[model samples]
Target chain A: MFIQLVVSGLLLGCIYSLISMGLSLIWGVMGIVNFAHGAFVMLAMYAAYYGDQLLRIDPLLFTPVAILLLFFLGVLVYQIIIQYVVDGPYVSRLLATFGLGFFLINMAQFLWSPNFRTIKESMVHGVWKIGSVMIELPKLASSLGSILVAALVFLFIRKTRTGQAIQAISADKMGAALMGINLKRIAAFSFGLGIACAGAAGSLLATFYYIFPDVASLFGLIALVAVALGGFGSVEGAFLGALILGLVETLGGYYVDPNWKYALMFLIYLGIVLIRPQGLLGRGKV
Target chain B: MMELVRHRRFPTFILLFGLFIALVFPWVVRDRFAQNTAIFVLMYGLMAQAWNIMGGYTGLISVGQVAYFGIGAYTSAFLYTHFGINPWIALLIGGLITALFGVIAGYPVSKLRGRYFSIATIAMAEVMRISFSNWEYVGAARGIQLPIEKESLLTFQFHSSRLPYYYIILFLFIVVNLVVYVLERSRTGFYFRAIRDNEEAAAGLGINRSFYKLLSIGISAFFTALAGSFLTQFSLYVEPDYVFASSISITVAMVAVLGGIGSLGGPILGALVLIPLSEYTRAWLGKQGQGLDLMLYGALIIVFCILEPKGLMGLWKRISTKKRTSP
Candidate 1:
């Protein structure tokens, strides 16, 4: 039972890691928490859902389309809203993303009608059992997809020119600018890339999870927690944080009461933050 | 001396006039809907004022103040319903308890800076919500419904008319504003602003950062709790979801931001504008639950943040200064 719980928890953590990777990148580079990140995921899910409904395309196949669409949307949002408040006070920056989140959720509600939709006949369905442990196919697919996408993003940040520029900006904004990097363009690109990850995760989630306007609230919040726990800007830390969150929530919920899972996650976060304000794998001062 | 006396007398006259209008507002208006809106504005305004102390002045932008408000409501309601304590007494006790809680919570929370601090407050509020929702002792998610009591000042209920509720909340609104007004110029106020503007500088000047932060949160919690208690007595119900919902915290912050943070009159102006706009929008466009009102609300916040970060007060200041200079 413990093995099964741990396995399932790890699988769930993959999707969480994918979501928070985007958040971590945005936070790391831009110094703004994209509160609308969950909304971006929600939008991607809707994109995948509509793609399947209208063209009879599988969500798996529609993933690239969702990613590109969300990439543009993310860039557009950055150019229009975030760019203005990037240098503003904490209140303005916080409210900008918060309002963006609210606006997107309500816009989704207005457009899609506040009803839950699921991809009933996804390309992946059914469960696999090995040695008395059951793994749902869609969840497994999501985990693999999440890891692949996360790896791609990780490589992009490590190897590519733009990715290195993003890293440079995050490391030291003024120094990066002195090195002839276009800070604005790089910031916008990073925001788009971060959101593109959400698009990928959302498409994967549509295969298993219900797609709704407010669905982002839960995932966005958890992703935020993951980002914070992993330390503000450390992608690897957020990944580990996501995995730990999944384990703690699943194992804690199973052993204790399921109702206390969220509370427990928050309590642990508070505990960790008090002791290590910079997060488990994060660098720099709080 | 003559100029100073005139300057002081002018504000006193305005104060007296404003008091007279507020005292007779419900009676003169004779519109239940308008009275109800007025009551909500005052209640929310009071809460926003409380938020301004910790958020605006102290630079701790907490998106989780609803936790204290919920605690206050739950504490008062629990005491009144279970122990048969008079609500007035329960209100005071609740405020005191929430103040203590604020100080305690502030200990660990005050250590966090900027976004981390805000996120921690959110996590703390979420913990409160989940705990209250799961606690069977307090009826869990079903919430506690207060018994309808005699309509009296002592009971804090008004069955005959909304007039009494209006007056009570109005008094609270005034008292809270008065407290903020005093705090704005007090030594503690300077300490709060000093910390907000530059924490290291304030700390260098022998100011204890965490202590002032705790003091700010405690005072904010006390007044916020008072508002919460009054809300329970007014509505005769206490639900964890309604009181502890994150939207309440957001709305309180929005009110402060919209009116102008770190100003005595900002919340009052914000409440006056926002409550009416929201209520009217909800009434008009919220029939099918299409969320137009919420969408507008969100857009307004975004637009205001981007265009005018200081809000209406900033706009007012700009226009006034421009006019003064031009003339």
Candidate 2:
């Protein structure tokens, strides 16, 4: 029983890590804590669900297309909404993203209605048993996908020139500008990449979890906590944070009441805020 | 003399006139729909005022005031149902309990700066909500239903009549506004603004940044919880979802932002504009289930913040300033 829970928890953590990476990237590169991240994730889930149900397209096959769509969305959001508020007051920036989120949520409701949807048929199906513990196949594949993508992202950041440039910009915006880095391009790219990751996570989760307009609220919030837990802007920290949180949530649910699990997670977050405001692995930003 | 009369005396006159309208509302408006709408407006107004203190003045931008709100709701419901306590007294205890939670929550959360602080607030509210939904003793996913035998002042039961709720909430609204009005000019308010503008500088000036922030947070939580308590009485049912939902927090925050975050009368203006408009829109378009109003308001926030971040009061000031400057 414990082994099964641990495996499930780890799988849950894998999805969380992928989802949170996008948000952390946005924050790290652009100093923006995007409130609409959950909403954007909601959009991606719909895309996958429709891709499957409406077009008879396998969600696994349509992942790249969805990711590309989300990338453009991120860029568009940056160009139209985010740019206007980049230099504005704190409240304006917050309202802008929150407004976008609210708009998207309502727009989805206006169009699709508030019904729970799932990708009924997928390329990945069923579960694999390892002795006494049972592991769901789709979740296992999804976690493997998460690991591969997370590794790719890590390598891209550490190895590539564009990635290095992004790091430079995150470290010092003025210095990067002085080095002739185009701020707009980098900002747009970072935003695009961040949202693309959100798309990817949505595609993976749609195979298993129920999708709805408000579905992003739960995962998005959890991703946010992961970002804070690992410290903002640290991908590896986010990974670790997500795993710990997922594990804690599952174990805590079993040990203490299931209802109090999330509350306990939040109290842990508060504890972190009090004890290590800088985060376990974060920099000076917090 | 003309300027003083227009600026100062006009406001006082408007306040007196508005008070008169509030007192005469139940009698003047015989329509049940309008009465319920007015009560909702006043309740949201009180909530906006509560949010304004920590958010507007202290620049905390909390999105978790719902934690206190839910706590207040549950406290009052539990006290009245289980312990057989009067809701009037429960009202006070509810506020106190919520405020106490605020202080405990704020101590560390206040240490966080910018988006982190705001995010923490969201996390706290989410945690509370999830916990509320899971706990069996507190009704779990199924909420608590208030069992009132008959219409009584002791239990705060107002079945079939909206007048009692209207008056109670009106009094609560006035008190909250009065508190904010005084707080805006107080030394603590000064510290709050100083911390908002610059924490390091505020600390340099010997202001206890976290202390003052917690004070405002506590006060804000106290009154916001009062509004929640009133909601429990007026609705006569308490649920985790209704009370602890993030949308409730967003609505209250938007009200303060729309009215003019730092201004004294901003919350009242926000509530007056938002609730009536929302009611009218609900009547015209459809139910909130359609989410049309949300889209409209969401777009409004985006456009308004882009164009006039200072909100309605700020816009009014700008127009008046331009008029005064023109010739």
Candidate 3:
């Protein structure tokens, strides 16, 4: 039971880490916390849902399409709305995104109402027995897939030229611009990339969790906690932090009352914030 | 004489005029729905004023005033239900308890700056909500119903009449504004202003950042709790969802922001504009479909943030500047 639970949590953590990486990247590079992040994820989830349920496309196959669509949306938003306020106070940026978040959420509510919907994908529901322990095969596979994708992203950022430019911008935008990097292109791409990652994570989540208008708020809060715990900008930190949170949540739910699970997560977040402030494995200033 | 009337007497006259309007509002309307709406507006105005002290004046931007509100609501409701305490007396006890919790939450989270502090408040509110939802004594998610009794000033019970509640909330609103006015003129308000402008510089100047932050939190929490207690009496029911909703916190913050944060009159302006506008939108569109008000509300916030970051006060400033130059 312990092994199974741990394994499940580890997989869940990978999903969190994947979703949070984009947020961390955007925050780290752009110095803008995208309050619309969860909204983006929600939009992507709906896109994936439509693809699978209406178009009869496999969720895995629809991931790339959703990613592309969300990337364009990100690009449009950055160019049209975000760029104008890039020079404003942090609160302005916060409000702009917060407004966007509200708009997206209410738009979803207006369109879909408060009804909960899910795409029934049989691929993620299969179970496999390993020794005496039975594990959900689809969840395990999805977890591994997410981990693989995260690794690929990490490697791409490390090796690719555009990735190097992104890193340079992340380090210092003006410095990168002086070094002949196109700041605007890089920023637009980075926002798009962030949304793309959220798109992938949304599909993965839709496989397990039910989709609703307010689902993003819960995931967004979790992502914020994960990002905060993982050190605002570090990919590896997000991975570790998500894993830790997942384990804590799973164990707390299993042992303590399930209702107290959120309380436990919040307590852990508060404790870390009080003690570390920077997070474990985080080298950057919070 | 004209200049004096414009500058000095105008403000006093406006204050008196506003008070008169508030006093006669219930009598003028006489309709239950409009009176009820006025009571709600006053209640929101009080809540928004309390939120402004923390978010606008202090620049703390707490998204969890709902926690204090919830605590106050539950405290009074619980006392009245279990111990049969007078609702008026229970309001005081509720405010005190909620103020204590505010201190506890404020101390640790106030150490964090900017987004982290806001997120911490959000987390705290969520925790409170979940805790209230699960706890059985206060009726859990099903909510607690106030015992209906004969209309009494002490009991805070009214028999299908909003007149008493309107006056009560309006009184609270006036008291809150007076407190804000007093605070704004005090040294503590200056300290908060300094802290909001620059914490490091304030600390460098030998100011205790934590102490002032906690002080702001306490003041804000006290009024917020008071508003919450009043709400329990006005609504005649208490629930986690109703009191502790994140939207309540957001709306309060929005009012402060829209009216021009860090200003004495901003929340009142915000309440005056947003509450009535939102109510009208809901009344008009809610019959057609749900969420139309929210959609418009979200759009307005976006437009306001993008175009008028300084809020309506900024617009006022611009018009005044133009008038000055036109001569």
Candidate 4:
């Protein structure tokens, strides 16, 4: 039972890790918290729902479309609003992103009316029984998919010239600029990539969980905790943090009342923030 | 004599004007809805003042003020419902308790600076909400209904009239403003401002960063709790949703920011502008459709943050500067 639970937890963690990597990257490189990160994910989930249920486009096939659409949105947001006040007080960025988040969430509510919409997929419902234990196929597939994407992102960041530029900027923006990298293009690309990751995470989420306007708040909070736990700028830390959170949540729910699961995550977050403020993999100024 | 008048007369005039407005506001409104709004403006003004102390003066942008507010509401409601204590006295106790919690929260979080502190406070608020939702004694998700009795100033109760509540909130607002005024001129406020400007430098100067920050948090929590208690009495109900809502924290911060943040009159101006505008917008748009008010509110915040980082006061300053330079 514990092994199955851990397996399921690890799978869910991978999705969380993917979602949070974009957020951490944006924060690390651009110094933009992107409070609207979860909102973008929520919007993509809605798009995926419509695509699968109404347009009959499978979520897997529609992921690219969502990524492209969200990338443009992210770029527009950065160029128009974020860039203007990127050098202002910390609170300005927070408020701008918060305002954007609020606007998007309200827009989603206006369009969707708080209804939990799910995409119907027979493959998701399939379960594999392995000697008195049950494994969810959709969960397994999404986990594997997230891991593969994460690996790709890792390679891209490590090997590609653009990815190296992103790393350079994250490490030191002024230094990178001095090194002849165009700050504007790098920032814009990083923002777009962050949104693209959120887009993919949204499609993965639609496979199991229902999509609603408020769903972003939950996932956003979890991703934040994961990002903090993993280490702010480390992609590997994000994955590890997500896994820890997933296990804690699943185990807490199994042992305690399920209603208190969220509280448990918060408690753990408080503990870590108080005791280990830097997080497991976090470095530099938090 | 003329110079003496210039120094003293302005403050005296402003104080008298404030008093006059407070006394006549209920009568001026006449309608219950408008009176309710007046009461809200005053209550929000107090809450904003509290938020300004921490976020504005101390430079801690807390997003968990709702936790202290929740404590105040829950404490007063619990005391009134269970022990039949007068809410006026219960509110005092609630403020004290919440202040203690504020110290606790401030202790750990004061170590963090900038965005981390804000995020942690938000998480703390969430945790408080979830815990309150599960703790059934205080009515949990269902909310607690205060036993409605005959109107009494001591009980902080009213049957249908908003007059009594208006006076109480106005009194609280005045007291809070006065406190802020006094504190801002004091050594402690100087220390807070110094720490806000530069923490390491303040520490180098032998200023106790943690002590001052915690002090600001405690005082801020006290007033926030008092506002929460006032809300419980005015509404005659206490619920986790209303008290612990993230929107409450946002509203308080919004008021502080939309005004001049660190300025004395910032929160007051913020409340004066935002509360009525939001109320009017909601009333206007509620008849037409859903979510329009929220969309407008969000847009306004974004525009203000982007265009006028220092808020309406900043815009005012800019206009005045432009006018001065035009000639």
The lDDT for every candidate, in the order shown, is 0.88, 0.84, 0.80, 0.83
C-alpha lDDT (0 to 100) for residue B105 of candidate 4: 75
Q: Total backbone clashes of model 1?
A: 0
- Judged by DockQ relative to the true structure, which candidate is superior, 1 or 2? 1
Better model by lDDT, 1 or 3?
Answer: 1
Tell me how much of the true interface, by contacts, candidate 2 captures. 0.73
Q: What TM-score does structure 1 among the candidates reach?
A: 0.94
Please list the residue runs of candidate 3 whose C-alpha ends up more than 4 Å from where it truly belongs after superposition. Answer: A282-286, B1-16, B325-327
What's the TM for chain B in candidate 3?
A: 0.93
Assess candidate 2 and give its TM-score to the true structure: 0.92
In candidate 2, stretches whose alpha carbon ends up further than 4 angstroms from where it belongs are A1-3, A131-133, A154-165, B1-14, B25-29, B152-155, B287-289
Q: Give the local distance difference test score of model 2.
A: 0.84
Instruction: Tell me how far the alpha carbon of residue B118 in candidate 1 is from the true structure, in angstroms, after superposition.
Output: 0.3
lDDT of 4 by residue, A160-227 (tens): 99999999998898999999999998898888888888888887777778889988778777887788
lDDT of 2 by residue, B148-222 (tens): 658877768878788988998999999987888777768888888899888889999999887898999999999
Q: After superposition on all CA atoms, what RMSD does each candidate show versus the true structure?
A: 2.8, 3.0, 3.0, 3.0
Q: Tens digit of lDDT per residue, candidate 2, span A1-286? A: 8988888889989988988899999988888878888887788889988888888887767777778999999999898888787877787778777888888888888888998887776788987988999998888877877777677777887899888888999889999999999888989998998898888888777777788888867777888888888898777788888887888787878888776887887778778767888677887756
**Candidate 2 at residue A30, lDDT?**
82
DockQ of all models, two decimals each: 0.71, 0.62, 0.56, 0.63
lDDT: worst 10-residue window of model 4 chain A = A116-125
